[model samples]
Target: MPASSLSPYTLNNGTPTPTAAHSQPGTEVELQPYTGGDSEREVPAQATDRSERPRHIFSKHRKWMTVYMVSIGGAFSALSSNIYFPAIDTISKDLGVSATDVGFTITVYMIIQGIAPSLYGSISDSRGRRIAFVTALVVYLAANVSLAFTSDLAMLVVLRGLQAAGSAATISISTGVIADIAEPDERAGFMGTNAGIRMIGQAIGPVIGGLLNSAWGFRSIFWFLSVFSALVLLGLLIFLPETQRTIAGNGDVPLRGLYKPWSYYFKLPKEWRNAPVPPAPKLEKLSWRTIVEPLTYVLRMDILVLLSWGALVYTIWSMVTSSTTTVLLKTFPDLTQWQVGLCFLPNGIGCVFGSVCTGRLMDRAFKRAETRYREEHGLANVNVKSQHDFPIEHARLSLMPYFSVIFIVSMALYGPSYDFNDLRRHFAGNLVASLGLQFIIASTATAIFNINSTILVDCFPDNSAGATATNNLCRCLLGAAGVSVIQPMIAKLKIRNAFLVLTGIAVVFSPLVWVQWRMAEKWRRNRLGA
Candidate 1:
């Protein structure tokens, strides 16, 4: 093939003209003219040719609105977990349970968090995103209401797990929804937006939890969550369209009965929304196989390695956040619940900042990778087929080392922030210095988490939710272990030593990213063949 043939459009004086780009003997679809710059690239012929690319009915505005809704949906999981942070001590005392027993509630929550997504992802992938989301929210709403009235430790632990089952899958389902609507090149930005919005829950949950706990006791936290979730669920039922590609291909399929949101009737133009389209395919019956499907990705060495690295990073971060209230109260005995909650403000700020920035950075990296692919292949302005040609792993992981360094340094300093002996002697004695370190730690770690999530979606574009569920399973389980041990570790080996251990673990796990980077392409190709 000639170098000029690489691009779909013929360049006329540096402008792309309408033309067929790729017409290889085995090519499935011919590329149409490139519309303009990087932003307005040619729509895939398959999009219009249903026999090839299913038509995408969502306008850009509609697609983004879907993202925002799912982002809010995903945020409930983070909100539920983070909101409980400030109430740990209060809940323990109220239930007449040991702090360790209270921590068990988190462990159960994490365990459910790990497992529930697989089931939810399966439902979302097969049945529909809307149904899966609605189901999860209903369960979550019920759990919150029950939790508000519970005074028993066992009940609290069980209710938390039910809450996890309800909310944990939102992250996976949201990723699946993004995959349904976005192309490989632009996925990170959308994923980043989703994550950024979700991180808001993480950032503000403690503050809200703290204030609510102080004002009306810890039970009020559950009441707030119940009310918030109910509102979100109502909005979702009314406005959130189904985005599972299998069911609502390209958002073109006119859904019926429960499949269609109320917005389908009012928000969309009747002609466009009611356009003739293929009927939804028969959904597979949910079985053990569907539940086990996500685990298959875990068996892939490259994905496993990537997941392991993410689990390590997430576990470290979870340990910190889970223990923060306890640590702050111990360090400053006079600190009230609200005061301790305020301490989390920096970390939350970092999460929001990091998620958004990392997403934009990932998009830029993908664009750079596209440019590099063209240069290497001696092509001009051609659309490099993302799945087969783009250096996706490298583009996504390019910023991993920087984040790793940030995490390591910040985590090391984090423990010492509370060590009065060290803080008094060192220049890092001030409150600002302490919180600044937390901010850095949260930002960098959250960036790493987002990067892993972005790459996972890239690797399994068709099964984005399933892939993310696998990631959630790994990280949440590891996080459960980390949360289980962190408080005890801090008690036995001062916060400083415990964090140093975490930092060392991060260093030890750093090479896993390199391994995944090296092997990702090969593994993906092998999977395709299989």
Candidate 2:
């Protein structure tokens, strides 16, 4: 490429800005914000028009409804995992396998869950969110149907991985849709609501799974999922719109065929119906790089710290939830599958509540941070020049310390709550103790989750899905590790000591959040060479 063709320019000042030509040989330019002037062409004549300002074409109601619609898919993704928790024992018995063998199903599911989203996110980031959503649902629906008919343990594990491959995309895609619609300042509430809904699916899965398993056998759980996913898939086909900016261009661009939501066929105004569909933008090629893009984000120190912090909480929560059935069964040997599933309700409820409250709190924090930034820089009443200059890390990380404390304290108490003998003799019944502790731990973990998720998307606005996939990748791998060994760890060290060890590990890493908060902007600037 020519030197001029490789350069970028600023519109307002006509200043030559840095490009690959300006960077040292062999150094990667990680993040370069769009500077509005392509060196290969003249600046567009219409660029000066204030009336042509780029903005989302969606109405407020439509934006939120779109989020809610996609969240159902996210919920299904989570439900796929959580619903299986209650069936572990039943599946073990029916498949003539040990509980440890059944645990591999969860592990395999999580592994695929971690790996598959990079593909989905890459596709959605380039092709369109609708295609990604539709493809995932179709694959997931087929997987669930297969799982319902399978009797072999090895087949069950393999099918579980296939199921994960399909459903896991919804999570990253859901966050991507939020990025496509909401502004950075307003994203927390939207993300919170989405995450909360997703967490709710995870929360209630065991209850539904237990009920279905107890009444209709473990196969019924897969049957229920197949039906629920088909309904969700129908809803997406009918109502979900293409929101990927590269494809939809703020919702005004006409979409055709699979890219167009069924409702848009009649609901779009006559002008849009009659308008021409522009040639689709070139999509990112599906290659090794696209599949591995999320993994590359792990190389960034700031993202690494943020991912570690979030993954630690996620892994601990996974350990706690996975162990719930085993510990509860040991504590209350007479408890039925339904009762064991019902015990998870409080934890789920807490996650839902925490997500809502923390979302509003994060929005408030953003406003406060923005206000302070404006005052400090003497730019009151004006938006920051660009999000790059804003202190988003501070705004988002403000709540981490408080929530981290809550998580640690509750996590430390969670293990002892499993001690039925002590619980019966001293405080409350073992059931009540365990549920209460689980509730607190789950709620706090969710609050931290909302914070981490919001910041991750804000940092990578263009690649929100990819960023979230990276977050999922980290958490799922760590969670798999935590869950796979939790039983043995608990057996060898005792639940109380094992939990204490987990708590100490979290304590050691908790400061990384602080480190990220303090150093994120510096790291970002270094990458941008600002």
- TM-score per model over all chains: 0.87, 0.90
180-268, model 1: which lDDT tens digit per residue?
88765668899989999999998999999999999999999999999999999999999887777667766656777677889767776
Best by TM-score: 2
For 7-90, candidate 2 gives per-residue lDDT tens digits of 454343455534434533212122223445443433321223322433356777878898889888988767888888888899
Candidate 1 all-Cα RMSD: 6.9
lDDT of each: 0.81, 0.81
Candidate 1 residue 36 C-alpha distance from true site, Å: 26
For model 2, the run of ten residues with the poorest summed lDDT: 24-33
